[model samples]
Target: MHLSFKNLFFTIASVFGIFAILILAKPVLIPLAFAFLVAFILFPVCQKFEAWGANKIFAAFLSMLSLFLIIAGGLFLFSTQIIDLSENLTEFKEKILEIFTDLTLFINQNFSFVPELERGELLEKIKSGLSNSVGTLVGQTFSGTAAFFTGLITSIVFTFLILIYRDGLVNALVQFFPENHQDKAHKMFKSVQQVGQQYLFGMFIIVLVLGFTNSIGLLIIGIDNPFLFGFLAAILAIIPYAGTLIGAAIPVLYAFMSYDSLWMPISIALFFWVVQFFESNLLTPKIVGGNLKVNAFTSILSIIVGASVWGVAGMILFLPFSAMLKVVCQEYIELKPLALLIGEKNYTDSEKDDKPGLLKKWGEKIKGWF
Candidate 1:
């Protein structure tokens, strides 16, 4: 058989062209992606309601309402804690500065041989840079907030429409292809939905567990604002490894500054380490399992790239998006290799045993054919 260079080039170009479109249309695509994510997450609830004799439109409305209520309740509960934190910002800043000064003095005393390590100048430079960065960030935030609200309104409308006519949309998409391919398209859509639903539900449980554990642990460790820290931890937990460490810093620093003894901060750190240990070994394996099984390295790399591309929203959405991408590729014969790279190793003994035997069988078959 002859290789079709023309077909190969067209395929490669089409793939790159789509990627280019995604990047170019990111302003629009980001909100659409977020709407899809919200719709995917609430799909199971809608399904259950539908099964319970509610119509699709009514079920979708109820689900969306439930989602809104949950969000609003959380915001109300956390509002006071956030306000308290903001009010104490000056105190936190002073405490941070004092700690920095002490650290600078200690470093100067211990590392006097390093003449270029002038703590005062370094501190001044850092302060100036931080101030400038903060000013720029605030300006960007104001502009971004306006855009975010606009997007939120649009996404809500889009989600409502999607839920109301999800079946119709699916039918239209399936019909776009040939009749023979329609079944395949429908199967692929179902697979994607199943994977997305499982991942979102599992992640929601994981986040709640982590949040509650963190809250209780911080309170036990004598952190003043346990709830706020817990909430922070929960939000951060969405991003995997990086979120946990970053979330831990709030309570640890609070403990360090508020308490006279270092033991408080030390205890807080130890508590988080223990909780994380349990989460990784017990909770995650049990709750999340091996489904949507992305590799740890890929998770981290995706997070970094996602954060760069779409900020916090990107980081939160990237995992499942990547998982869905993997599922799509896994369904295609030509892209299975890419899926394997992103996926976890098959550790089942049967699969492991079959690997070498399959290789030998293939070799023998090739020899016989020759």
Candidate 2:
């Protein structure tokens, strides 16, 4: 009993210590974490260039430059789309006011016993609240913008350094373990690298497929700025359950505001539902693969924990981080249960294909009779 209590105390203390450190050192640590992910994505390209006879430094530089160009171009396009969207803010505001008017009328009609406030009074209260909070909002926006740029610069620098000294880092990590376990350490390192690369590449492909499909569907439905909403949805889909709902809501609300017909908004919702269906059922299983799949409950819990700890960056980073954790867990005998707890049920292709139902057997028999 004493030993068990001692172990429990130490475990709790260790967890709290780690949490405190993460919260306190977020500014530096978050960027370093992001840099590692960037390095994982760029590592293969760097290796390819090196294999083609370029020096490691030059190869890293070239890979980084390529990534920079892709990001800058995407940002340029997104900024232009946002500018176009902003130009119609007056129209959007008008629609919002109309929505509030309709909502107020509906509530007043449905609940005659409830006291009704004047629409102008409601608007006045909202305006006053906004005016009072303006200063706080402005301060936060400025601080956030500064922090974003700082993190971006730090991550870029760190990514380059990581790519340049990757070999040394690997050796250093391996040496941290005892001499006898060095081979296992190297294997774990390779596993981490491969998992990170595969997961990131798979996510990239899913995003493209989702974006294209979403845009095409919206365009066919005759919505304005289909590409813009589709792109936004694709990006937001990275956040899992909550993100898809929010992403779909944006387009549905826009469709309602932009179109007089109720069918347009309904159709928009249905389209997203169908896209999400394909995504979960077909795209994800086939592309992302079972290897990186986390249990649904664990994934949600991780996202909540990550968001509480580190905000939006944590939400984006935690999935790959969790997958890496699973990989690490699998490397140790004692941690195998942890890997299983967080992972999805794995089925081999033969097992999946070998399951033939009674209906299938009957159909085969009928076909043979015909």
Candidate 3:
């Protein structure tokens, strides 16, 4: 294909235009995006039930029921710790005041001069600011939580619809391509579904393992609410790269504030470091790495773009979607370069042929059927 100024202008316009639409339509699109991803994960389960002679409605309901139960059980388990934590809000407030007071004193003694009355006024202002911010944050949190559940409900409904009509939905998508290429499009969709299933299932296992190990480590170090913090960290680990560090920071700082000894914080930090090291080096690379087959740059770029478009939700969803995008792109001549740009580099075709990931095996089966 020849690169032309008009074509370049159109491409740039299309890119920006799509982003504008994504931003404007986010309230609906975000939930729809999530629903599609969840549908992909649950579709195989639906199929399994159908294979066992269950009706599509029953199969979809069963899948959704299982998910709802898992979520409810998790929330139930966390409720006790949440209540305990809520009871300590007074202590947390005091800790914040103490920290602020210490900072003010340090500034007065070491960095600047302040009259006694001025110092008191400054401290009062700081406290008042924090109080207002905290109140605003609390309100925002409640509203955000409500919005989340609403979206979740919407996603569940969409997933059920997608599950029951998966064949028609897929056929609709495949119809977008030319008639001659529709068969290839169908195979690509199969690969996309296969990748989604593998990635999600592998991530579930990784999170459980990480949560168990983190809790055990924290328990050994005598951190309060070890399981709660451990699993919270594990869930945040879904964010990729910096997520582990961000997740670990909460409990480690809490440890510093809660324990009189310095070693408690040190131990919490150390535990997370070890877990992160192993997870980065071993778990992810071994488990879900093959599912994406994307290079570091593309994955990171997708995360950044996703975050910019949809905040944290984008960061979590975009990576796998990029992988799926790559699968579809590889089938089209015009977009194959995009696939090459995102995909892992293999020096030789022989090297790629030598090792087939699970996704490749499934994709091969899909292609075989066509």
Candidate 4:
């Protein structure tokens, strides 16, 4: 009992210490984490370039340049649409006011206990609130853009250096383990790298597939800037389940404001729903495979914890980090339970222990036909 209590205390203390450090050191750690993940995805490409007669530095630069070009091109197009949208903000505000007035009137008529407020007074108050919010938002957006660009440069620099010194980094990490476990350490390193690359590459494919499909659907519905909204949604979809929902909101809001009829926004929502449903069920599994599969509950919890700890970057980073953690846990006897906790049910040892019944296996096979 005493030993168990001691172990419990140590576990709790360790978790808290790690969480505290993550929250406090986020400014530096966020970029480092971004660099690390980017390096994982880009290292193989750099090696390919080097094998083709390029030097390591040049290879790394080429890899970074390729990524920068893709991002810059997308941003250039998206920003153009955003500029157009901003020019018509006054029109959108007017439509919003009309909707708000209707909502207020309905509430006032339906409920007698509620105080009947003057439409002009209510509009004035709402206008003031929105004006303040817009001002704050614009200020934050400009400031944040500068910070984002600065961090992007830092991440690119770190990625290049990491690719150049990756061998040294691997050796240093392996040295942390004892001589007896050095082989296990090397295996762990390979497994983690494989997991990162697979997840990232799979996600990239998913984004392209989603972007193309979403653009087609939006165009069918006659939405403006279909490519911009589609690609933006696809990029944000990297954040897991919540990201799809969040991305869908962007186009839905624009459709709502741009069109006179409510049908456009409704159709956009339905289209996103259908696309997300298939992407989650079919595309993700087929391309990404089950290498990094975590249960939905754990995925959501990790995202929430990540957001709390490091805001947006944490949300993007923690899911892959958790998958890597699970991979490491699976190699060690003491940590196996943790691996089980974070992993998907179908992927866990419990499922392996009790050979799945024939009926269950058949069910899975039949379900896969969809």
The reply for model 4, stretches above 4 Å from the true place, is 1-3, 77-80, 108-116, 132-139, 345-370
Candidate ranking under TM-score, highest first, comes to: 3, 2, 4, 1
How much is 294 displaced in model 1, in angstroms? 1.3
Reference-based lDDT, each prediction: 0.78, 0.84, 0.82, 0.84
Which residue pairs in candidate 3 collide?
Answer: none
Evaluate residue 27 in candidate 4 and report its C-alpha lDDT on the 0 to 100 scale.
68
Q: In terms of TM-score, which candidate is stronger, 2 or 4?
A: 2
Clashes of 4: 0
Q: Which clashing pairs does model 1 show?
A: none
lDDT at 42, model 4: 83
For every candidate, C-alpha RMSD to the true structure in Å: 9.1, 7.9, 3.5, 6.1
Measured against the true structure, the TM-scores of the candidates, in listed sequence, are 0.81, 0.88, 0.89, 0.87
Model 2, global lDDT: 0.84
The regions of model 2 sitting more than 4 angstroms off are 1-3, 77-80, 101-116, 346-370
> How many clashes (backbone atoms < 3 Å, residues ≥3 apart in a chain or on different chains) does model 1 have?
0
What is the C-alpha local distance difference test score of candidate 3?
0.82
Candidate closer to the true structure by TM-score (higher is better), 1 or 3: 3
| Candidate with better TM-score, 1 vs 2 | 2
lDDT of 4 by residue, 1-370 (tens): 2468888999999999999999887767888899999998887778778888999889989998898898888788779888887788888879879788769877887885458677788788888888889989999999999989988778877888999999899999999999999999999998898778777777888899999999999989999988888988999999877788899998999888788899999999999999999998778766665546777777999999998998888889999988889899999999999888887865555543244323334334653332
